[model samples]
Target: MSLPPHPSSSRRSRLDAYQSLDSRSPTTTPTLSPPLQPFAKRVDSFTSSSSLLSLDSPYLGANRPLSFGEQKLTSSKFTLPHNHMLYLTPDFKEDDDELHMPEPKGQRLGIERDGDFASWRGFVNLGALTLVIVAWIALFAGYPIIYHFTSHRWTNLGAFNLGGTNGTGQVPIMPFHFAVIDPDTPPSAYSKPSWNDPSTSMELVFSDEFNVDGRTFYPGDDPYWEAVDLHYWETNNLEWYDPAAITTQAGNLVITLEAKETHGLDYQGGMMSTWNKFCFTGGYVEANVSLPGLNNVAGLWPAIWTMGNLGRAGYGASLEGMWPYSYDACDVGTVANQSVNGVPVAATINGDAGNGGVLSYLPGQKLSRCTCQNANDDPSKGLLVHPGPKHGDGTFVGRSAPEIDMFEAQVGGGDVPTGEVSQSAQWAPFNAGYIWQNTSTNEVIANPSISVQNTYIGGITQQATSVVTNTDQNCYEGVLGCYSIYGFEYVPGFDNAYITWVSNNQISWTLNGAGLAADAAVEISARPVSQEPMYIIMNLGMSHNFGPVDLPEIPFPVHLKVDYIRVYQRADQKNVGCNPEGFPTIDYINQYAEAYNNPNLTTWVGDYQQTFPGNSFLGQC
Candidate 1:
């Protein structure tokens, strides 16, 4: 077989072509190369020549050293297929055999070079798509963490599922010793019928042990608690709420109600609040309290409750909630059933009977004052409607009633029995009916038996003497007195499910912190109007329902003492906290408290009107 064309010969042929273009050659008729053989035969001939040329070929390096390109082509490691010709002549015609180049050895671009190059692009596209999808999922799942560091507001979406002292994602604090259900434990351990802690969750968020003795609550004396100076008119209590009446002693908060007249009221009492300071949506809340007097303490009323942050305590109905009701909804019923103007008021706003209508004009109806529309004297014009003011994340912080009465221990008034306390929640339902009055005749029509003022849509009383008793005298006042842990756990976002209140009314109690059986006292559902962020309020007042004060039985200078107050909120719920839009920041709240504490700065630092600008206090116009 002939050897492949030498490098010198190929270069010499190219030179000869150039010489022929300049010099004359005999113009002889070209002989057609003996009737050209088939193209495959030519390829076979070329392959034979290439196969003969090897690394030890005498033709190689016989003349001179090979150039870099020529050496690479002649290397023993590089070989071309004997049947496939990668190189084609200028006039090459189509042939039966396909042309192929040498495949790469080993890995190329991180993939096996098995000659399937086209598939690499498909694999790369699929890999890129997978990475993008995973990136999006991580971003969405970690949003709360990112928001915490970047944003200035607080959110209830809670931090990441971090390890905490009390189960998962909960801060360690003094756990309520009376809890009957351990959320962290399995349900099968309990013998009685069980439900989740109220709404299946609990995490400690706020706590105040009143650890500092002789601590006086005067405006800014305490960071979390403050005293209110006002005559509370919502319940028409005879006593004026005085800030000077609140103090702490022996690790307990004390509120004294005395006969000394103040602020035009014949009597004076004490009120403490956590307004505009800290608030939460829903969770377990509890406090250890000692009542001022026995259950039959004629007019004395002591309460531990919560109210939405959109209302200030001292302000009248304009800035304060209507107590126990959220945003208003008016329902339509027959005149005989609703008793309004001798005619059925049309349900024009919210649609039909079940859904409440907007607070608009209602002829001779007294409902405008009954609902949140009481903020405006003439709500018929529809000037201000909730969800009223836009705040954090542009969500409306409503100026509506969202109250949860944990316990109001009283007697000789309302439906409460002597020695028993009441636990309840309240809200304005869409089906709430209204009373109407005649324009000229001045006659009112309604069911005399059903008064909305004293009615409790959702309520329950403490267990009877068999379950709880105060005979141990383990409390203040020394005479048949006792201390009891009273509290309730609230869960929002349920449809028509009444709230559950938890109480361990034992005067001298045990931890019995396990599962509890389902019973009437704890299972009574109340109106669910407490969906917003509510602050804490503890006060002592005189109730009109109990008639005149029994001065002899519960005389002047009565005391309502509290051992501690703590709050546990749902870890997975949404909440608004310090520095949220339209709300004061923790630093600002502290700054105000500092100024209030300064005796030289006589002017009140928390003048709601001046301190909070650009909108009305609690969004009340």
Candidate 2:
């Protein structure tokens, strides 16, 4: 800015200054300056030293020869060592163009982009897999409700069946029907004895009083049963329950099947009653009776049966005290042949339904009919299938032609029911009883206890009073059997027998039989004057010692059918009498074995011998 100086002088001074500056710089010579190049020229820059250095970071000129300018600066002219000169050179250039390294050209860039894309795809695929797994779980775990909402209102895919009561028709309940009641002779001309009557107590007992408007007894009607003392709680109390099927008549009061019999032995278990708890009474009574229908097989034992209530006696004649056993002719004790000597009454009716003998009796048989023609269905007998043959007429009959036979009887009809097998040992599943059916005869009988409460007079509750109403009307057979309890073996007659009760104080009985004397009267009175108020009693017995002593045969699956029994008496009245001696206990039994089985699993231990070691032989009683 002062004045224009001479170029030569200024240049010389600048040159000297440049020389001095170069000495201060550690690697570069100040005399050199950057050179300009065309854009196309830069394309071949790989030939440059900078390019070589960038290609490999280790290209730090460590082994490269030193630059001429650096050599000159380090050593005089050319005397410097090569390594020393190279070491003095700078590691790299700081040019703007050099600082920015260009990526490889062409295919290399494409390859790098492809690698990035592959990695992104892997991440995306993993995310999709996680989403799919979550979706699958949500769908599978909630299928129950989803299926129900889309299908049936009430699902049965997962259901339980119990007693045909699941509201679903998946369970099977055997269909056995009963109709008509009559009392006549041997319903099966194939059997013994002529006329018969219902073997059970008169339905009149269910009413406030007997029929015939409380009919007076015949002159020789001295049926007397003494009162006895039956200890309860102190001993094993026999539980008597009211039937769950039938209800008491309107006029009926609450007949106590209750465990409250007031009398000692006379009326033991609460107010017990065979009528209130009996399931069936086997065998025939001595009377020709007729039911509402005709042509019906006339079978009689007594209308006291319990598919359920096997032991329930009314206070008036509580069987509770006599529970565990009784000297009833059917159960144990010896007695008059005509005496009603059985336990509650056990019987079965099989052979008659074309299931007679052992052949047709086998399960899965095609078709079999009753031994009687009209036993299955009859217009005259109105399906004479229940009660008994019309009122004790030896004309009642059960007929059927069998395709086969359970035993070798019906094949020839040569009196087969009484073969040696008839007397052979028979046994129930649960060690209940053993029954032997007369394959040839129509007798389904057993050796029952001889005496119940030891009758003081000849007249007692036996064939004379009532006959089994459900077995063939002419109850040539004398018992009914059924045993289907939880955890207990399902015996032969248990499922097939038609046993039920419907009453607070009464037990009515009905079986598969078509003949029973409807309304046939059979009365059970302790005496003209009983304790008045007593408990009910009931049991299932397979034997009754009362019968023609000559006929000692028994039957198989013999059964007693019952519907419902009723008990009626003055509401406020109570049995007032000292009970008799202790009621029969199992200890009272004196037999080698019961003829048939009691499905109810009570009293009988099947083999009287079994009791011998534990109870009988020891005389535990």
Candidate 3:
């Protein structure tokens, strides 16, 4: 149905006014009509349809002419601010068009607005990420540099493993901080005589410098040492001789004594001998040694001495007759005792086998088997038994051996037995003595029924006595300091038989160029002046009822360091030679002797007196 459009009240007013103005005067202008309502809403009211707004409509309201201001507003292109009102020209045309609403002004799709605060936040995050990456790169680059300079380089020196069923574990390959030599410390202050110097007349014989380069598990493998595996020998010691306790380090032979258990014993230590390897008839032997220095702990009996190798092969069969001779430098008093018809008897023989029945036996005569003992039982008395036999025909029986004492120092609280006596504030007191069987007493040997002449005699007072005077200072001065040089010189004569000396700082001798004093020297006019080949033996033994019974507890793993053992013989005596089968090779001896030779060997003479305070006979220099 088609109907004519009705005018609104506002439109009626404008029409009436216009008619009145025309009636009043034909030339008068009428007032402008008020603004029209929105055409979109008016169109919506006219028809209830979604297509009322056409696709190309400009105003969608009335068609009116534009005023000057409306023409200016329509001529300019402007965009509407968000949520602000929209303006249209007064002369508007209707057209169908799509209205595009401006997008919301704030954030979209989680992206922030491009403002000062947002920009600053983004800049800070980027800077933080950059810093993290730079730090990682620096760490990677600098790590190798730091490690190259500061990291520790591990080595197998002075290190050993602690675990294994047989206690023979692989040596650890790690750096031992404590074992490293400090670069700032000075070297050893003392120097020993070189046997090969032209000015020196001695020739090197047998030596074990213990200069092995790599780690050694057993010292016996060195070809020059025979590790003693004996459990007990005369002395009732508490320690068992263990091969595990021996090691070579720092160019020294190290023997450690520990308070641990092994072989069902509470203590363990080491004993090494050159029994069948290298033996000498007469020569000068010395060893540079350092003892364990611990407080309150006693029962340390360390010795470096020699034993007769009579019955051994290569040695002259005639020498086997003198197999009983031994040179001992021991810590405790050495005595020999025998039980006569079930009666306990004792005597102080020092190192000599007294005029007893043991020596009375003729060649091929079997000696009566008697109970013999050493200083292990009582200082005043111990058992002495007959040494089985010397020859296969049972000739030369009994304990006719002579023992020479080189050096022995006993400390802690105990009875002072025989030998040279000295006291120290911080160390074990020292008492050294020498004894040997004097076969020169022709009157006793010539007597018939020599066994009856072997009657028990009380203590035969030693012809010579030794004293430790204030003139000689203590070798070990501090509570934990013990280092000494021990040696002996044997001359094959009754006048000045042998002289042994022990000094803490260096090897020293008396002022007369003799190694020992006239009284301290071991001299036997008749026989038993060390006429047979002997071997070297060094051991660390415990108490044999020898030292103080109330000894303090000893700590574990105490060390004894032997820097080197040097053997020398006079050039004239070197021609005497040695048994090729059992002694050191001649080539080996000559090589070492030649290597150690120096033209500056004469410089040692003056310096030797400063420490030894005596005429120097170490060399012909």
Q: Return the top candidate by TM-score.
A: 1
* Residue-by-residue lDDT tens digits, candidate 1, 281-313: 656667877778655556677888877654445
lDDT (10s digit) by residue, model 2, range 1-621 = 698889999999998965666456465423332222233223344477556444543323323555867555544533323234344455644456344655543333464432354567899999999999988877886676576554323211111111121112122121121111112112332122211222322221121111112111111110111111223322233322222211223211112222233433212111113111111122211111111111121211111212111122222111211221111111112111111322213212211222221111111100111122233255663321311222133322111111000000000112332210001111111011111111212122222221011111111111111111121222222221221110000011222222121111112221221111111111111111010112222222211132221112322222222222222112222111112111111111111112111213232223221221112111222
Write down the worst ten-residue block by lDDT for model 2.
Answer: 402-411
Off by over 4 Å in 1: 1-201, 320-324, 328-399, 413-417, 429-480, 496-498, 505-528, 546-548, 574-621
What is candidate 2's local distance difference test score?
Answer: 0.22
Q: On a 0 to 100 scale, what is the lDDT of residue 278 in model 1?
A: 56
Candidate 3's error at 225, in angstroms? 0.6
Using lDDT as the measure, the top candidate is: 1
Name the candidate, 1 or 2, with the larger lDDT value.
Answer: 1
Candidate 3, residues 1-621: lDDT per residue as tens digits?
Answer: 996566687799888854565465434333344444455444545564345544423643224456767655554434223322122553443353223324343443455555455577898999999999988877897787786765544321111111111011111122322111212122331223432233645556545556653434343243334454445433567888776777778777787777878778888888776533455666667777666534334556666666543222112221222223222211111122211222211222232355432311111101111112221234453221122323334322222123343444344342632112121110000112232222233111211221111121212222121212111212332243444566665654344454433344332331111222222222211232444445666776677544652245555566767777766777666522223232222222222222112212221223111111111111111
Ranked by lDDT, top first: 1, 3, 2
TM-score, candidate number 2: 0.18
